[model samples]
Target chain A: AQKVTQAQTEISVVEKEDVTLDCVYETRDTTYYLFWYKQPPSGELVFLIRRNSFDEQNEISGRYSWNFQKSTSSFNFTITASQVVDSAVYFCALSEGTYSSASKIIFGSGTRLSIRP
Target chain B: NAGVTQTPKFRILKIGQSMTLQCTQDMNHNYMYWYRQDPGMGLKLIYYSVGAGITDKGEVPNGYNVSRSTTEDFPLRLELAAPSQTSVYFCASRYTGTDNEQFFGPGTRLTVL
Candidate 1:
């Protein structure tokens, strides 16, 4: 079985503030994939980032960055200079990357981030 | 490309009523999935199909059913509408491979009373 935990249920910050959302995961498979999804008020989930277990290198896409630490089994996402548009429920997800579980994906409860102007 | 699309963007159902939620993708993805999102909760997988005719249940599959008769279409069915079944349903599809990015649909909001 696989599980994802987003400890922070909700967080609020003013615009331009940097916020980091933490994600922890548990999986029996030695290899797996981690993902972050954003669900805005519109109710549609938008895929933010996807990282495989093998690639521990951090990623930076404009204002968004992700830290994947295999040793700690944590994948954290950070939004620098967050804007009001970034306010949304962010979800951390996991999937078995090995052939053991195929492509079953599991999601965490989610963290509602609010960026006020 | 239309990516992924769902029908009846919103629907209201009476107790015990039945309906099917439609999902289609133009990307020719081999893996399709059905997930339901509740208020303040992450999306829960209900069912998935690797290809046409191959379907499997996911974490929360009690009140729903799904069928994948064609590569481009996967439909989810709710046999007996209940308030507990009310949620926002999302359809997603991904290419045939491990750890691939899944494209999501706009979602369908269903209310049961």
Candidate 2:
């Protein structure tokens, strides 16, 4: 069974503050893929990043960063200098990377981030 | 490129009514998926198709049916609309490759009453 857990239901922070969204996953598959998506007030899902199980290297894109730690089974996302535009719901997802079952992705409940100016 | 597109951005269905959520992708991807998201929640996969003819159920498929007659289109059908089936429906597609990153549609908001 593959599962993704995002314990923080909602978080509110002032603009320019740094916020981290925690994501923990449980998957027995040795080869799996993890992802983070952003859903803004517009209600469209935006793909943020995708990290494979083999790649534990952290990634940074502008103010958004992802920390993928295989040892902890966690893929945490952080927004540095969070801006009002960064306010959105973040979701963590897991997918079996094998050829047979790679089409399915299991998503976390989600974490809503509210940025206040 | 149109990426992925869904029809009827918003719809209201009465109990026991039926409708199909249409999805089309211009990318010619081999894998297509249908997922539903409840308010303030993550997405739950309802069905997926690896190709034009292969389709399978995902995590939540109780109230939905899907058909994949062509690689560019995958439509989800609701046989009998129920309140529990009301959610935002998203369609996605990805090339059959190592990345497995799915491109999503704008989504269809469905309400059942």
Per-candidate interface DockQ score: 0.59, 0.65
Cα deviation in Å at residue A78, candidate 1?
0.8
CA deviation > 4 Å runs, candidate 2: A99-101
TM-score of chain A of each: 0.95, 0.96
lDDT of 1 by residue, A1-117 (tens): 788999999999999999999999999877788999998888888899999888999999999999999999999999999999999999999988663344777999999999999
Give TM-scores for every candidate, taking all chains together and pairing residue i with residue i: 0.96, 0.97
lDDT of 2 by residue, B10-108 (tens): 999999999999999999898999999998789999999999889998889898999999988999999989999989999999887648799999999
Q: What are the clashing pairs of model 1?
A: none
Query: Taking the tens digit of each residue's C-alpha lDDT, what string does model 2 give over A1-117?
Result: 889999999999999999999999999989999999999999999999988888889999999999999989999999999999999999999998664554588999999999999
Best prediction by TM-score: 2
Model 1: residue A39 alpha-carbon error in angstroms: 1.0
